[model samples]
Target: MKETSEKKAIIKKLMKEGKTYKQISEETGIHPGTVGIYGGKLKKAEREKKCFNGDRHLCKTCKYRASGARSGCDYIIHTGNERGCNPEVCNKYERGNRNETKTSSKGK
Candidate 1:
């Protein structure tokens, strides 16, 4: 049997390649739910690493951050909400959606 670290490495690599949870589970003999849990944790860690401002709430490093505006970020104007940043309109969200489409089509 492969070690836990080796399994996690394989899972992360497969995920990065846009593989689905079911595909990863079949290849690694791990449960789909477990694969999803691991992937979620890895994604969170990667997001933290990508956040240059160090604070998720503050938009200091975000490109859409407003310059001396009362609302703070451009996301509010775009979405008409006070959520600061909306992942729905974020580039990262779009990229993830594209990857999901590819993976789903491949699975089918």
Candidate 2:
């Protein structure tokens, strides 16, 4: 795996600056749950590299990949609507939703 020192540094800096995960996520365009996951805030049951499965096709059926929505897709959230997830490079890709209903775009 490639080193994520830069992203880790940013997360640590944001936390040091007293920025909440929501703030960091908005600033970096990373999904908030990912922020929590990497920051050691949210504990996951079966953790793996988000995109290690190597199947962009899976995104079509992913709960996180909502279609025609105004916002909230992982791809749209990070790289805007112009691009779709590149399974080869997207370590942050996820195939499912968090284990709860989200009332807003911001993650818990």
Candidate 3:
């Protein structure tokens, strides 16, 4: 088994490169679940460092935010390809109902 420090270093490098938890698990031979803990720790540390830099909206204005259903001004917005927009900053942002259809069914 890799030492704690070594595992942390590997996880940090993979995260910096934007590798997913699954990818990190595959490359590091660590379990997928454990990868979450590792990644979370790395993210926390990064957030702390960045926090000192200023509240540079990591999710609100992130270019990586997806363009569709999953779009919302939250950290999870960047988790996938779904587009997100912050209602507070984005005039185009709309509050969607979970059961609402994207298209009208009047003709159906």
- Top model by lDDT, which number? 1
Q: What value of lDDT does candidate 1 attain over all alpha carbons?
A: 0.63
TM-score of each: 0.48, 0.34, 0.46
Each prediction's Cα lDDT score?
0.63, 0.59, 0.61
lDDT of 1 at 81: 54
TM-score of 3: 0.46
- Candidate that scores best on TM-score: 1
Distance from true location, Cα of 23 in model 1, Å: 1.0
Better of 1 and 2 by lDDT: 1
What tens digits encode model 3's per-residue C-alpha lDDT throughout 4-105?
A: 789888888888899999999998898888889988877776666655323334444444434567753433433433334433333333344422323355
| Better-scoring candidate (TM-score), 2 or 3 | 3
Model 1 residue 101 lDDT? 29
Candidate 1 vs candidate 3, lDDT winner: 1
* Candidate 2, position 15, lDDT: 76
Measured over all alpha carbons after superposition, the RMSD of each candidate to the real structure, in angstroms, is 16.4, 17.1, 10.6
